[model samples]
Target: MTDVAIIDYGMGNLRSVAKAIEHVAEGRAVTVTADPAVVRAAGRVVFPGQGAMPDCMRELDARGLRRAVLDAAHEKPFLGICIGQQMLFAHSAEGDVPGLGILPGEVVRFDDARMVAADGSRLKVPHMGWNEVWQAGPHPLWEGIEDGARFYFVHSYYVAPQEAGLTAAHTDYGVRFTSAVARANIFAAQFHPEKSAAAGLRLLSNFIRWAP
Candidate 1:
């Protein structure tokens, strides 16, 4: 079987994600591909992306990866990171752009007004740093990871699912937001697990072995 396929649509540097998966995939064949066929044929799919929502959507379609992504999300174990996670929703406030609608939700930016720490310090918009992630519940992908482990984040926007049950984990910066989501065979994270160090590696390893 094609063990893992990391979708490449030219959004961001996908090499880190590829290397991280390679570290955990054992001898599993990991392919970084832009081909729709490879993505559809893979046993597991990791959709990692960054940048603005509108551009991401356009690039996805332009590269002819739209249908393949949707298919993998429905048929196999799927993992989405950063904008990859946001694109799974119905819409995004980033540019009033529509998404794949695989999940019922919208991606919204962190409020500028609420960008303050408890001591009244200014919090940055990108939220670029390590933040504590509170696990919403147990899942196979979270195996060997603590509930409040810190993960690296580098984005200004976060997703708001229509259903609360879809939240796999949450984190607080300006306000609490869905940092990770899971339903059926899909699990997505707003944080960049590839850059999150040991805890991140553990999560990736779990995903490699996750059968659901």
Candidate 2:
């Protein structure tokens, strides 16, 4: 069985993510871990979050798992979900907080000037509900997923990576923003695959089979 560690950084929906991985990977062993040592030993690490970027970074620093996760991302398969993906950047405009600096970019809040709501309600800040993803690269992590397939999203802020190649998929809210990113062994998604139904499951299964 493949050993997958879901980092418990006191932010993400760890239980839901673990359960989703189990459902997709079949008999694979999944553990919700907060220990850096345990995370270091895992074959793959899934960092999932759904809170402020700065608070998430603080939790990671306090637990001393930042280095372990970054090293794992370099040497092993790593997946970041929601704010977990945003934290991979250098900083976030959400709370004037510095991120893990693993990836080059910054998380910024959706601008009303650039966004337009169909209902015309000043464009909601937290972009909640299903949004279509337009695939960019030919990364194995997105195998079997169709372009423009809708995925579950619930985020107020979005990542804007400095490197364009890192963006694997994009979604349109008010403007087009990164929905997924992949660079070598590192992979991340702004959408919630656990709650995205069949398309999301297929995406996770692809990640399970992806080779770093």
Candidate 3:
């Protein structure tokens, strides 16, 4: 069985993600660890988070998980979720803070001024709730997932990759933005798969089956 490690850096929804992975893998070994040694030994890594960009970066740095994660991404399969995905970029407008710089891009907030609201009120910053994901690209990470499938999204900022072909999926708020991304062995989703229901489970399963 494949051993998967969900990096526990004190900010992610770690338990739910681990449970969801267990549900999909059945008998596979899934462990949530804050230790860099365990993360390095795992066959796969899932970087999950539900917090601010700046705080996430600080926690990873303070805990020394940043280098471990980057090393794993280069050699093994790495899955990042929510704020986890945002950290893969170069920087974020949220705190004007630098990211892990795994992928060449920056995270930016959704501008409500450009959107036409029904009540004439500005669209909320944190775009919570279910939204349809329009998948693009042919990466193994999205192999079984279909286009227009709804995924649970809860974020104010979205990733804009330097390479357009790296965009695996997109979602619309005030404007369309990249919701999923894949480059080589690294994969990430702006939406929360653990909170996305069946479609989300299928995505997780696909990740489990994906071989680096």
Report the lDDT tens digits of candidate 1 across residue range 1-212: 57899999999999999999999989999999999999988999999998898999999999999999999999999999999999999999999989999999999989999899999999988899999999999999999999999999999999999999999999999799999999999999999999999999999999999988
lDDT of 3 at 101: 88
> Which prediction has more favorable TM-score, 1 or 3?
1
lDDT of 1: 0.95
- Model 3, runs deviating above 4 Å: 117-122
Q: Pick the candidate with the highest TM-score.
A: 1
Q: Give lDDT: candidate 1, residue 62.
A: 100
RMSD of each: 0.7, 1.6, 1.7
Quote the positional error of residue 46 for candidate 2 in Å. 0.4
Would you list the C-alpha lDDT of every candidate in the order shown? Answer: 0.95, 0.87, 0.88
Scored by lDDT, the top model is 1
Q: In model 1, where do residues sit more than 4 Å from their true spots?
A: none
Against the true structure, candidate 2 reaches a TM-score of 0.95
Tens-place lDDT per residue, model 3, 1-212, is: 33999998889668889899999987889999998999999989999898888899999999989889989888898999999899988999988999988899989988777764556667777898998899886777666777798999888889999999879888877788999999889889999999889989988998898886
